[model samples]
Target: MTTHYLTKLLRYRAWADQLTYGAVAALPEGAAEATRATIFGNMLGTLSHTYVVDDIFQAHLQGRSHGYTSRKMPEPLALNELWLRQQAMNDWYLAYAQALSPAQAAEEVSFQFIGGGDGRMSREEMILHVVNHATYHRGFVAEMFYQVPAKPPATDLPVFLRDVSQP
Candidate 1:
């Protein structure tokens, strides 16, 4: 993809992430930590997992080890802490995308996956994977919100285009 296409996608990713985290943070005490049967176990677990994956892919893009044995976070961060970390990662992605030339964006990076396999993907592919992966988990968070009996913010791409996109 062109830099503009990928930058727009990443920007939307950040916008939607902020909306998701804000909604969760606004919930009553014990809401995020509530018991649940979802993957990662609950809202907090799922959110932390997403950040951990971002860190993994960040390391991959840098050609370094992520130093994690598994995708699961050893301990979940507090909601505010997770929000800060995710925001920082989101900003990093935006800058990374903005700095890439089209040729550079297509350059391939080779790295090992956390689960013990060698892997390679173009810069564009890696970034797309991050965006898609987080979008999937954000859906998880949205479902968890339903369990909490709260309405989640609409984070769909069309919504981003309508509300947060640059003309």
Candidate 2:
């Protein structure tokens, strides 16, 4: 069951990343810099925050402390660079997960949080948390795209499954 869930989550993450990159690519050159939000301050900032959080969680899964200090807004990379990096990270995660056994998934792992405290969780739980975290942020990005003239790609899990099923 855990492996099945992991497979679905991996697929969802890949689909979501592709959708995000597509939306980001369609934006005007300076659109990410211009769009402001109450919490994230801007689209670029929000996306950077999402990336930073993912990095932090990835480090945690590796039993290391998070290195990022602030959610520094990444300079707009070329669409290819952005998409390639996202795809690489997602592929790495899927590979890591596929290598795990049920016993490994149930094992407790420890790592330090960004601020100061040590944290521990089962590998399975951590993987699920990472998926949930990405989903939440992707939803935010999807909302940001809704305000723009060009429609973002459909990010819903069912939509992703349906599209993948067709071909």
Clashing pairs in 1: none
lDDT for each residue of candidate 1 in 1-167, tens digit (9 for 90 to 100): 88888989999999999999999989888989998879888899999999999999999887787888889887778999989999999999889988988888899999887877888899999999999999999999999998989999999999999877995
Tens digit of per-residue lDDT, candidate 2, span 1-167: 48767867887888887778777777978666566563675555566666676677778778765667664534555446656766777787788788889998888888766666888888888778777777887777767775664576788888877877332
Against the correct fold, how does model 1 do in TM-score? 0.96
Error of 2 at 100 (Å): 0.2
Q: Which regions in candidate 2 have their CA more than 4 angstroms from the true location? A: 71-80, 165-167
Q: Using lDDT as the measure, which candidate wins?
A: 1
RMSD (Cα, Å) for all candidates, in order, is 0.9, 2.6
lDDT of each: 0.90, 0.72
Each model's backbone clash number: 0, 0
